[model samples]
Target: MKKLLSMLCALLTAIGLPGCDYVNVKELQPGVSTAVEVRQRFGPPQHEWRNEEGSVTWEYSRQPEGAECYMITIGRDQVLQSIEQVINEQTFARVERGMTPEQVRRMLGRPASSQYFQLKQETVWEWLMERGSTLNDPTYFTVSFNPEGRVVGTGRYTKLRP
Candidate 1:
């Protein structure tokens, strides 16, 4: 029975079952959920950014395997301010040339993967995005930076999933 259960779990994962690492942020009310509660539910963040207003934005990246990256903000009072899913078309449009890699990371959270091209003197970061209305269509959004570490280009591509 234990072996059978393990097999079932593996099959579910292989078929891309939702909620594997999904967090229902709607249940976490802004201005109500404390920082401690946020940490309890999401565990430690991959990165934390301190804002000028004394707020901190925590990055929870579900990458490489999962398709969403969440940015949760905590006010100076230690209260939850907002929860945003940063991997989307709107955010992608915000990326522009001359922007630094840090700016990109802040806007989009951590990427699924990064690759450096030695000859081209460029670094490309990739993020897996939602299929949205399309079925079995795996999409990837990419940001490319030049040797100076400034945004040079952005692109998107889809690979059909079996």
Candidate 2:
């Protein structure tokens, strides 16, 4: 059953339907949309961050299949502040050595996957990126962390999708 569901999701994503419940952010108004409306559209968020000023930002990740991660911020007055896609090249450039996993997650939402290399004592987190116009290959942005959980480096690579 799980395998069937996974395949179904992959098919939907491949056809350009967003994997995150097919969220349509275009219909949502920034300052006019209510928290209730946002929740109704996107479903419950994967994680929520409360700002120092009392605003909240919710993360909706469509990863390991789809290429976008959204960060929707709601103001203290309960109005939607802004909707941002955080998995682009700009956000990837912000990741630096010595940054913690929490920092990376906050900047890029959640990664698509993570792997631990026992021999190298390193952990790598990868986020699948949107394919460029010139290539249909799968591209990934990776952040490698040392055993102490601090980022050591960042990388980008493309893989030919089968």
C-alpha RMSD values across all candidates: 6.1, 6.6
lDDT (0 to 1) per candidate:
0.82, 0.83
lDDT of 1 at 155: 96
Task: Write down the worst ten-residue block by lDDT for model 1.
Answer: 13-22
- Model 2, span 70-157: residue lDDT tens: 8999999888999999989889888999999999999898898999999989999999896554557888999999999999999988
Model 2 scores worst on lDDT over the 10 consecutive residues at 14-23
Candidate 2, superposed: residue stretches over 4 Å from native: 1-23, 131-135
The local lDDT score (0 to 100) that residue 143 gets in candidate 2 is 96
Scored by TM-score, the top model is 2
Q: Give one digit per residue, the lDDT tens place, for model 1 in 1-162.
A: 755644454454345443533434655689999998776566678899999999999998778667888899999999999999988889999999999999999999889899999998999999999644455577899999999999999998887755
Estimate TM-scores for all models. 0.82, 0.83
Clashing pairs in 2: none
Highest lDDT: which candidate?
2
